[model samples]
Target: MIEHTVKAFDADIGQLRGLISQMGGLAEDAIAQAMLALQRVDRDHADRVRADDKAIDAIEAEVERLAVRIIALRAPMANDLREVVAALKIAGVVERIGDYAKNIAKRVPLIESEQRIEPVSTLPAMARMASEMVRDALDAFAARDADAAVRVCESDSALDDFYDSIFRTLVTYMVENPKTISQVAHLLFVAKNLERIGDHATNVAEMVYFAATGTQMAERERSARSL
Candidate 1:
């Protein structure tokens, strides 16, 4: 009976991890599709991303329900508890990432059929970095490697730098070409959303680190408790 119970417990945890992985993959796709939609000015692709948000929302609800049930019944300890807690943290980040996807989707209609600004370089780079961060963070969680998690978390710096550069460049565009301010402003929001997505991925990496090491490696995660 104890053996069966242990199997059941492991199964439940596996299910939760599976849900996290599913949501993470969806978020990655949403961001990638959103970027493609932007590059191609494809309204249909943007609509697809907006539609996928509902599915991501459903996954989050399921993840939370399972996590809560496991906590209530199994009362996992040590590594198990850390894993569940990390799963919960990741669920929230994945949902926020979906939200960013939706935000970018909203801009598709506004920008489609309009003339794009020159040097649309940094946004794509930022999206690629953010997407990779999400994937790497999930990988670190699955592997339970604190060092890998730390590396993933540290990667956000490049995304932030790219975001800031885009911001400055866009502001300059708006100032120089006052007539393009409206369009440039929309792109600014997209860049900001992508940057926020990176932040969420970093948060997941930190959670994974805590789960693996039981000690906070980043000041941002540690300072989070005081708040």
Candidate 2:
């Protein structure tokens, strides 16, 4: 009876992980579609990305349900509890990332009215970096690999670098061409959204590290910090 109960508990954790993976995929799709809409000025694509965020939101609700059920039924101890909580927290973070993508898409119309600028290249490149961080962060969570999670944390700095460059470029343009200020402001918001997505991905990575190792990554990295 005990063995069977343990197996069932394992199954519940597996289901939770599976749901997170699905949510991660949907979040990644939203980012891609939002960026594509930005790059090409496609309203249809932006609308689709905005609509698709609902799916991720729904999956987040399911994750919360499973985590609560497992806690009440399994009475999971220590590591098991960590995983259930991690799934719940990660789901929330993923949903927020999806929201950021929707916000990015929402700005597409304003971008459409603006004249083309050469530095528009920077925004898409920033989106690509943010998307990759989201993908790898979720992959690390699925694998429960603390090393992979640490890598994701490291990648956040690079994404920030990308965001900084885009910010500087956009501000320079806004200063030089007062007429484009409205559109530049929209693009700035879009860049902020992508930067925020990367942040959420990093948050997920930290949760994954704790779920897998029972250690907060921040403490570990601080111990290894260079002067």
- Top TM-score: which candidate number? 2
lDDT at 92 for candidate 2?
94
Query: What is the alpha-carbon lDDT of model 2 when measured against the actual structure?
Result: 0.89
Compose the digit string of candidate 2's lDDT tens values, residues 16-122.
Answer: 99999999899888888888898898999899998888899889999999999999999999888988899999999999999999998999887776478556678
Q: Indicate the worst ten consecutive residues by lDDT in candidate 2.
A: 218-227
Candidate-wise lDDT, in order: 0.88, 0.89
Q: What's the C-alpha lDDT at position 61 in model 2?
A: 94
lDDT of 1 by residue, 1-227 (tens): 98987999999988998999899999999999998888777889899899989999999999999999999999899989999989987998899999998899889788643566774556788899999999999988888889988898778888899899899999998899887877788899999999998898888988998999888886665678889
For model 1, the run of ten residues with the poorest summed lDDT: 112-121
Quote the lDDT for 1 in model 2. Answer: 95
Tell me how far candidate 2 lies from the true structure as C-alpha RMSD in angstroms.
2.2
